[model samples]
Target: MLFGIILAYVSVGSVLIPLVLASFNWQNRSFEIRGLSILLLTSLICDASSMLLSRYHINTMPIVNFYLFAQFVILYLLFMRKLEIKNFLRVLLVLFCILCLIDISVFQGPYVLDTFSHIVGNLILMALSLYYFYTLLKELPTTYIHRLPFVWISFAALAYYSGNFFLFLLNNYLLKEAGSIAWMLHNGLNITKNVFFAIALWQAYHNRKLST
Candidate 1:
């Protein structure tokens, strides 16, 4: 069940990225934005591939490597951009990444550690996401139409990631039946993400004034 949910979530994101890109093709190329989009899309693809490989009881090392690479690229692009980067936010994000790595590695032994790590990661991610949204929302009222797509995309990312984090954290307690509740959370998050992406695509096209 966990595998299935993860697979679906990634697959939906994969499809939505292209659709959103096509909708906004007229905008002047912004490497930072494009790179971010590609990073996310690639990550989703890698994630989906990993899930499929695991489900088939096949070696998933390659997929995991790809996902890690995609994550690095995303981080690189995020840091390279000359946009505003609050010191506190930067520190928090770095710590969050470190925690994620530790959670994935050292916490893989017993279910207790696994559950604790999951909860911690989810809490940190949720806090970070909320901060991001608050900042973005503050700027939205003064932005132009072309910028709305970017804002909406960020919103979608926040929602999807937050949903997954919460679901995973809750699954540890609410659904202790290994793969049962985890699967449901996985599928639920995917469905929510796809819906957000669909809305984002529509908004992008609308902003473009594209004729159907």
Candidate 2:
């Protein structure tokens, strides 16, 4: 818990740096970078809220649900820019939203985390990240992808989503058996994710500077 709290605070700092950089480099505020900034801000707020609500023994699943939905939207917007299959992504996003609503209202109660929504959303995000990579390679054969801000951002999302895929699937069992260690692992992975986000954001700032 303490570890999670500390990491959450660090994550806030990671988000703030990019946000500040974006504000100063207004000319370089591309759609992708702006979406990332908003996503990070939302994540930070949701995480902080979850932590505080948990401390007070309040249910935080609704906040998690909001985060899950926001993540899908933000990631979709991020990838749609370069993906050729824009129609497919749009349909997927619609279905994703509908399913989340149904899951919350019919399948899962508001007080508990919606495991189905989390799983589906994470899988879609992972797939989109992979698709982004595919398109990047196909479209920019001569351009070095390593220098692209969106590439780093996609890589970070891919890594984080892929790493946590199974953990979320087995969350209930893990929490039941090894609650302490499970939370520690969750927080640790989250911290790693935040570090990657910071890197991606910094890369965005640097790339924008180069372009200008």
Q: Which candidate is the best by TM-score?
A: 2
In model 1, what lDDT does residue 56 have? 90
Query: Per-residue lDDT tens digits of candidate 1, residues 55-166?
Result: 8987765465445435443533443342355676567657756765676667553222244444554455445546556765676554554345554545555676677666
Consecutive 10-residue window with the lowest summed lDDT within model 2: 11-20
Top model number, lDDT: 2
Tens-place lDDT per residue, model 2, 119-140, is 8878988998998888776777
Instruction: Estimate the lDDT of model 1.
Output: 0.55
Candidates' C-alpha lDDT: 0.55, 0.75
Instruction: For model 1, give the RMSD to the true fold.
Output: 5.4
| Model 2 TM-score, 2 decimals | 0.86
